[model samples]
Target: MRKGFLKNRFVRVKLPALLFATVTVNRGLMR
Candidate 1:
């Protein structure tokens, strides 16, 4: 149960960072 909780937290943090990076890159390309 503890392991599952940690995994969920990891995904929540990592996903947003990855998404932000992608959006920033796309915006740079648009300019």
Candidate 2:
């Protein structure tokens, strides 16, 4: 129960930011 709630929160915020940062870094490397 508690784990599920934290997982949802992570997906809502942390996951997107993490993915965005990774993408940006990849783009920078591509340059």
Candidate 3:
């Protein structure tokens, strides 16, 4: 149960970071 909770937290953190990075790259390309 503890491991599952940690995995969920990791995914939550990682997903946003990944999304932010993608958006920044896309914006840079558009400019």
Candidate 4:
């Protein structure tokens, strides 16, 4: 249970960060 919670927390934090980074990179490339 604890491990799952940690995994969930990690994804919740890192997923958005990764997505934001990807979007930023795409925008930079578009420019």
Best by TM-score: 4
Q: Tens digit of lDDT per residue, candidate 2, span 1-31?
A: 6999989987899878999999999999999
Question: Could you tell me which residue pairs clash in candidate 3?
Answer: none
- Model 4 deviation from native, Cα RMSD in Å: 1.3
Model 4 lDDT on a 0 to 1 scale: 0.98
* Model 4 alpha-carbon drift over 4 Å, by segment: none
Q: Candidate 1: worst 10 consecutive residues by lDDT?
A: 1-10
TM-score of 4: 0.90
Q: What residue pairs clash in candidate 2, if any at all?
A: none
Which pairs of residues have clashing backbones in candidate 1? Answer: none
lDDT of 1 at 5: 98
In order, what lDDT does every prediction score?
A: 0.98, 0.93, 0.98, 0.98
Cα RMSD for candidates in order:
1.3, 2.0, 1.3, 1.3
Error of 1 at 8 (Å): 0.1
Q: What RMSD value applies to candidate 2?
A: 2.0
Q: Assess candidate 1 and give its lDDT.
A: 0.98
| Local accuracy of candidate 4 as per-residue lDDT tens digits, 1-31 | 6999999999999999999999999999999
| Per-residue accuracy of model 1 over 1-31 as CA lDDT, tens digit each | 5999999999999999999999999999999
* Candidate 2 lDDT (Cα, 0 to 1): 0.93
Ordered list by TM-score, greatest first:
4, 3, 1, 2
Give the Cα RMSD of candidate 3: 1.3
